[model samples]
Target: MTVATDTLQAVEAVFAERIEAATALGGSWALFDRDGVVASGGAGIASLDPARPAPGPDTLFRIASCTKSFTAAALLLLRDRGLLDLDATARSFVPEFVPEIPGDLEVDPTVRMLMTMSGGLPTDDPWADREESMTREEFSATLAAGIRCASVPGTGFEYSNLGYAVLGQIIERVSGVAFTDFVTHEFIEPLGLDMRFELSAEEAVPYATGHRRVEGNGWLALPFTGPGVFSAIGGLFASVTSLAAWGSWLAEASTGAERGPLSAASRREMQQLMRVAPKRHTPPALPGAPTPPSPVVYGYGFGLFVEFDDRFGAIVSHSGGYPGFSAHMRWHAASGLGVVAFENATYARVSQGAELALAIVLDAADRVAPVSPSPAPWPATLEASVALSGLVNDWSDVAASAVLATNVGLDVPYDERRATIEAAWAAVGGRTAASRTPVDAECDSPDHLVWFLPGATGRLRVEVRMTPLAEPLAQTFLVKVESPEPSVA
Candidate 1:
């Protein structure tokens, strides 16, 4: 999990770049490696109005949907205790919790479906028109009796906030404890995470105010109450440091490095990609152009978005957005890189911040190995150079656009964008360079490039690596190509 010194430096640079960019947009961010905090940035805005206190690392922000992962983990722990079965139907725990769908559909959503978001439940309850407060049981029963099944259970993946709420009900029925209490006892206290399910009136004084953009002016905070029925879905408020600790635990649990409340096998299962997400409908272009769907597929395990990266390996991530707050957490198991970003203003900046933080980590991974002395052989012909020049021209524009889109938090249009970037380098450098030799191709995959650029004194080098769909590419350019001197100072 430990990265090389050069890689660490590169990672730090990437963080600095992203933090600067994010702050320019008026947001705060925090990043962490496995051990602890590596970097943090931006002003902790005290108020969007007249008077308020600035936020800090310890500032509690509503983690929103990030709470689902915690709920999923608690359920998994209960399964390990032999008190629950993931494959068992939800009806086993609460028969009244069955969906109000056509009987001929024969759709029986399992506990696994609920946890993974494949339960065929609508994103929210159709019947619950009002956001009135209610007990967890009343909410679950109303949802079960009122919610319609849009598709067959386990047939498709649809993220359901209500599904997780149903899960909270099941947790209560199975564990015979309040959902929040169970989570605190089973997961929160065990990890020593400085987080709480709800903010008390007095405690709310230190919390950052959530904001939403208005017409002419900037942002305004929205008043929200503590989790009543939706406690398990999106109720937790936490700081970046606490979220980082949670991510680290998830990474350790996934890799079998640490055993928390859940067993290693169960944790690995949580990281497994189980279902492909349906193509996300493009919303009208926001401040930026419409974001293209992520290149990576979505999964249904532990309510997480799991994807494999060519560089950092497996990543587990989730994004949460509340009225005036946004949060994101991404953890790379192989590289032991964990990033968490939170913003008090609900400007949808959480995803952007997370992407920037991930870029930093991947950039570091790119520098893990020194560039080899030999470079890839070039085709010794002017025609080849001409052809490559055209290719590079086209690819550079594509790469630039792709990089811009990635940086600005837009969707990538094509899956081959990174490949094109690497191919562009090969085409351009392979044909135009005066001299070239085959370097180590071990790190040269379809998605990544790591090599040295020969120079008079030594060499100038570049390294490029792909990140998870949620993040941007981790790349480092103009790395000093060091060489042994010929017995002279």
Candidate 2:
């Protein structure tokens, strides 16, 4: 579906405003759907020292922890090959991951636990951010020296960069290649994505430089870290075009679109909620500020955040933050619309801008067309509704039995059910059954339906749900009078 030109401009404006509001040197954004990038633009400068313009679609930016999803996918590929079991102990591959949990529990975390961020390790961010340059041997020795965990293994959500780093080691042990090489060969190359751990100094001449704000010194350019053992946690540098492509491909898992390196099922699995994240308390709203948005509950999937919204369905997203860069990628599962954004500044919180940009497109789409398709009633369920209408009109025990399941009669005897239906019709000013058939039918699921029968004074609301059998029978049936609105008087 084509988004309006005005809507695209509104999207670009979001990022342009963010660069100034968030105090970042420069930033870029892209709006994408299942087809491809719908619109993209950049704002401010890419680097302050060199004074380069804002990054274009192909300009590289460090994605930080967004690389976790890639690390998780590699393990999934190995699992599909029967080379590793998700339930297997982490020590099965790397014996150095003997974490010291509270109460000195003997329970060890499985690879799946780490993937879901439920390995009981404490939230390690800025600390792990600087560990990028540590060599593989140093990482292994650090792990062997005894890593501390905050809670029991597999008990709850704890954002652990250490846990994912262990997964990278596991990948190297099983694939017989470095973690970076495995991801490059298996995912990046196969999918034709332009992503890497680091770019050469000459190659990065035009790349966006990472930065931090110094009180007296404006924006200070930070040096980039080289790839090492911790690269598995948050080490990849990617362009907005590449990041959008990766996110859109994962969103297509629901539609079972073109086959890629990962199977559609495995990709879908990556977006499924595995553990509920801790709730965050919000401060009281100020007098003149806009009302707070509906509460969003978050859960951890394979390597992504699954947010459940009241208006929209499941939304998958992940944010990345390092010393000098911040990034975010998010997509609505039902609509397949998404946004990718990056800022070359520390703790920029560019996600706020991306969220606003996405909300605009989704609201626009909802006005033009349904963001998600509504489910239709099954053919058998429609037939059953017709039969039910006839039974209500004629009141034959045999006819009612044919339309309903045996449990319907056992739960509420047929005699009482018929009496209820007759009383409801009488209240609607109908002595005899109305000639009108069912109208305004709607379905929440294929097996369930709600419709109305017009009466003289009011209408009778009928709701029915079918059994789950080859030849389904009406398992739930209800009829009640819905009176017209009361007069203003």
Candidate 3:
């Protein structure tokens, strides 16, 4: 797969844009093109000491849930050996892995469901106490027993970390090895990833420290961990260079140029759309704004999010965050334009940075060649709509409140604040008219839409900033929603 120089230059511009955007938000990032690191930016939180220097291609950052794709790929490797069946029930291998529901509610969720996150298992609450202390087995069992099915088995999409955790268990059962060990033995060693699930003190010295912000003060380092517990869900640490090598392999596997560890057919299957998850339900604070979903639909084959740009006629690829770190890898199979971003921040910061990086890449790609039409839109689901609406509402409230408190007087009552904000928005131009220009746009997920708003000087600006819930809560940009146009008919 060859990328033209012009296309590569556009990608470089995008990378530079993201680096600037990320630094403004006080984060650090590294980006890679097919050949290698084209550009890098922001030592911000990643560097506490100015003299220490910024992260480079070899600097390691935790890949977080991006690990799930590798885990899913490993499972496919097992499938290649006929060691396990994708269609088999969870109970087939781990007999004790039964869903702990009432007699009438018993549904034998298949391994496919787990792989696609449609396993009908309870979505794990990252904040829950159950997650903190439970062993992997106990955690899986608890979720299986307690999860309520929102839809029939393998029906609707619900993002479930628990489901992937179960997948780790399946890999263990089939490979006769622990999940991490399987990854190490099969993929890491074969590819020579030069990465590991955990770092020793010596290794840690050179690695970027994950950070979160303190409410009143500055950034602080986050607690560190090895990939012992979250091996299947959110683990794995590597440099951008090594990850680009992995991405190049994926591009080859997807395009039939090179046979990956899995067969080409299996790789294609992994990239096919499995189920459409609900959209982010939080609304934009301003009227007529568009709120993007997490992923319009998820593809089981690749074990990652696939966004379709009808205008671009391409599949936008993705994978993302966990507690202590975040990462993103995207490639347009048709164009051979790819971007890989790695950050050592919490989930939100990484996600924001990833989205920005994606926008930068897509903008560059568009400049190189007139982007082809996007693939057909996947079927929308009620679940997705609900999720999207909720996100819009949340975003709307937050934005409105911020505007009222900062731009207007701070002592306004809740109802009055909303009314004032709405009135202010109406005065600006009303929801029916276009008021703001999109500085940048990218498909963040299969159906999720992301755009950037520019400040007066024409620099891209983020709408909302978030601090992690934990101590040393890192500050990162949050998703910004655009107002929708009123119907003309």
TM-score per prediction, in order, is 0.67, 0.93, 0.64
Per-residue lDDT of model 2, residues 304-391, tens digit only: 9887767776888899999889999999899889999999999898877777777778878878888876688999999999998876
lDDT of 2: 0.85
Q: Find the candidate with the highest lDDT and give its number.
A: 2
Superposition TM-score, candidate 2 onto the true structure: 0.93
Span of 10 residues, lowest total lDDT, candidate 2: 284-293
- Select the stronger candidate by lDDT from 2 and 3: 2
List runs of model 1 lying over 4 Å from the truth: 1-27, 49-51, 125-133, 279-294, 347-349, 370-489
Model 3: per-residue Cα lDDT over 1-489, one tens digit each: 244565444444443454456422233344444444455454443556565546766677777666777888888889889898989997787665666543456678888888888877666636421242246666656655655554566766777776677788788878889888889888888877867777764544456767654667755666556554456786777777777677666655555654446676666666666767554332121122122223443344447766554444435455566554567776665554566676654554444444444454555556666544333312332222233223322335454433222322233344553454344444333332122444444433333333443333222222322232322111222222233433110
Ranking by TM-score: 2, 1, 3
Model 3, residue 58: C-alpha shift (Å) = 1.7
Candidates' lDDT values, in order? 0.61, 0.85, 0.55
- Considering lDDT, which of the candidate structures 1 and 3 is the better prediction for this target? 1
- Steric clash pairs (candidate 1): 211-324, 291-411, 292-411, 375-437
The candidate, 2 or 3, that scores higher on TM-score is 2
